[model samples]
Target: MKASHDLSGLVKFLSRDDWAFHFEEVMGDHFWPVMDHFDLDHEEINDALGDHWAMTLWGCAFEDFLTQVFDPGGQTFVEAYLKRRSWKESAQSKAYMTALGTSVMSLYEASEIVPGKSFLARDLIRGGEPVLISEGTATKTLRQWERVAARIVPLGGKLIIAGGLLPFSQEASDALLEGFKALPGKRRRSRTQPLLDDEMLRAAAPLFTHAFLFDVLPKALGETRPIIHNSDGDEIVFHEVRFPLATGITRKDIAWRLQGIPQLRQENAQFWNWLDERSQKGPLKARVPNALAAGTTMEDGTPVLGNLELKGRFLTLMVNSAARAARGREMLENVLGKMVGVPLTTIQTIEQMQEARKGRTKEVDDIPLEVATPLVHAMLDKQYREILDQPVGMLGDISPRSAVGTQKGREKVAEWLKYLEFRSASSQNPHDPMTTYDFGWMWRELNIENLRR
Candidate 1:
């Protein structure tokens, strides 16, 4: 179905000033409260390169583009829903329901969701008590999950919404998407609102590419297609594979297990290469996506291993086809369970493991980031020093200060600045999103690329 909204004119009216104010004023009006309620720490919404407003910049400009272009479409579902439902008496309620008409709302927008709290976690009933769904199964539960923009994109059928990657995290969003995917197919719920059709989405995709939202939603989501298809229309199917760790096995134990397997060994090598590239700092991040890896444990007892990016004991795999995913799972089972003597535990899909992790006790081990990470109230200053700027002697024996002297030093300094910017940019820390990191000093000192207003 065609969008009744005039998306073409969406960008026509949005000038740099509109965006500067949107993130600073409009978004801040809606965004900050949500962050506070969820205990999500953020300094504030800012346009670092406010002076550079060419129609040509890449990362920052595209981010602003999403801030503007996605407003109408993101509001489509809830706006239509509000039309069908009875209007509430409270003026505040009226504003909450109607707000989606122009802005993308998220968990942060939860408080003013009018009649219903839009930020509350809703569930999809897949036979028993509400289960966390698989990748693309059930986009948004009519009752459980509330952020329409967050849930819809992954279901391959859920309605489109205004929010993009900025407010919510990419990984948590992906996990939610997978939960929707894992829902039993026969009982899947039809979308609450009409989906923006291929024609509309095709027109919409460029807005994403130009806005750089594409960095979050890639063309090939494993083997799955976006519920809203893009024009590039690459016809491929991706499957998520998982091998659950035994009760006692740690992610650190994987190296010993893979000591003899040539294929997995090769795969492990490729994963690190991708991690190294992902960890590199620079403007544009000049990086591909972070390679998802499954490590049992590190030999050194290092709490952090191979980049500190593992998702606990569960090693999830992403392959193109179900057949390949199945085969890979079988191979891992044979290699890990039968040959290597890592005692074959019960085999389950990543979604199944995730679904089950829902009910475990606090003492029981559960998904690292999901069940536990939210409670972490570590000092921002400490994490900033530990994770972002720990220590690197790239210029022999000099700080970023001394390096700015020579041409080679300046180039190295640029890399350091870019690394800081890129890391803070791509960081998905739910507690401390990259936005919370204050890179204002470096931005001024480096005199890097000027950002669009």
Candidate 2:
């Protein structure tokens, strides 16, 4: 379940309040040394400078410098902090993200050259990255860098990272490709060329007035190896796939058509029991087969082709292995094609049923509940025990039962209960599949009742 309001706003609120986090490291890295170099006339200020509280003044001054000297005003700092937030949220960490994000933003903004008044920003470190705001390639900045380089090249404190570490995703690769085109270099994708930072500085002498250094750990040399995933009984993988169903078939016809597959017949021995129970009469009636069963949720809460008033529903399939998933999909497509006669159109969604459900006024009972329930069970019987232990973001990045161990996690579990409550009370026109679900299992599994009290 999604939060009613986005969580990003909460991050921003936290970033603004935690000022010490942003400035603590930078004060030690640059401010104290810079202060030592400057001659102060005021004895009172000088006496207060040795105290730990003095760093607060240094941080304010640095922020002010970033706002005035770097020209993007103060917005660049905000953007950097947001990036920090994004990185932190992606992992389960919190503190460094907001603090470092804000610090990086200001670092970019305040990174310009004051000619002779302050040292060239590049002279402090080398490359401008993680976001560089005050980077300038002006003639004066270039000449100053040339002078600095002549002085420092004999000594080494820099290393050029050359391209990026690790592989780039397609979208990220595309962006880098486009960006590389603008730089003064050949855009060869396959070449593994390395240029020293000293040579690069000599080539593009007047770099941006960026003063930032990352405490980056070098990647271990040698071939990158693929990590092998070995799952114990406690760890199981689930795959959700879509399969096409044949049109003009009823619930009984569906059971027969799917049962026609040798794999389905062999894998599920309970299929006959379900079909026999659905055939039974009186109030002991079983629900209609909802293509499959409860363990696997349908894409749009659609019934099998037999009940379709407007169009056929896609069979929502799930399996634990890639091989089984693919085989199941191909088999379903092949078998349904034979039964339907018309080329079975494999659908990924049930938008047609969604539309049909919307226009119809009555709570149409297309299929009985008794028959549908057991088939759902047959689909998930193998994986049900492990499902409760899997961590979900909706449960505050903890498993359901684990969420009850702490007060904060319990609050998240309560929120999850509220979300399910919303689902229970709601419907997708007449096609709500949640009604078929027994949610009591969740409460009992998590041991999280008595929330109201």
Top model by lDDT, which number? 1
lDDT of each: 0.35, 0.34
Work out the TM-score per prediction.
Answer: 0.25, 0.22
Candidate 1 lDDT trough over 10 residues, lowest sum = 296-305
Identify the runs in model 1 with alpha carbons over 4 angstroms from their true place: 1-238, 244-252, 255-315, 318-405, 415-432, 440-453
lDDT of 2 at 143: 20
Candidate 1 structure quality by residue, lDDT tens digits, 174-272: 443444345343223444421232333322322322222222323312335333211112112445554557767766665566555444322342142
The clash numbers for all candidates, in the given order, read: 39, 15
Q: Residue by residue across 1-453, what tens digits does model 2's lDDT show?
A: 322213344334434644435444433443444334333322333353344324434433333222221223444343444554544343322332222222221110122234333223332223333221122123223221121211211102231111101222222223333433455653333224322233333322111111111000001111232222112111123445544445666545656666664333122421221111112111111133211111211111111111111124444554443544455556656766644432232332234445657877755765565676566544443343454575544554456677788887876765555444444424543333443444455566667654411
Model 2 scores what on Cα lDDT? 0.34
Please list the Cα RMSD from the true structure of every candidate, rounded to 1 decimal place.
20.6, 24.1
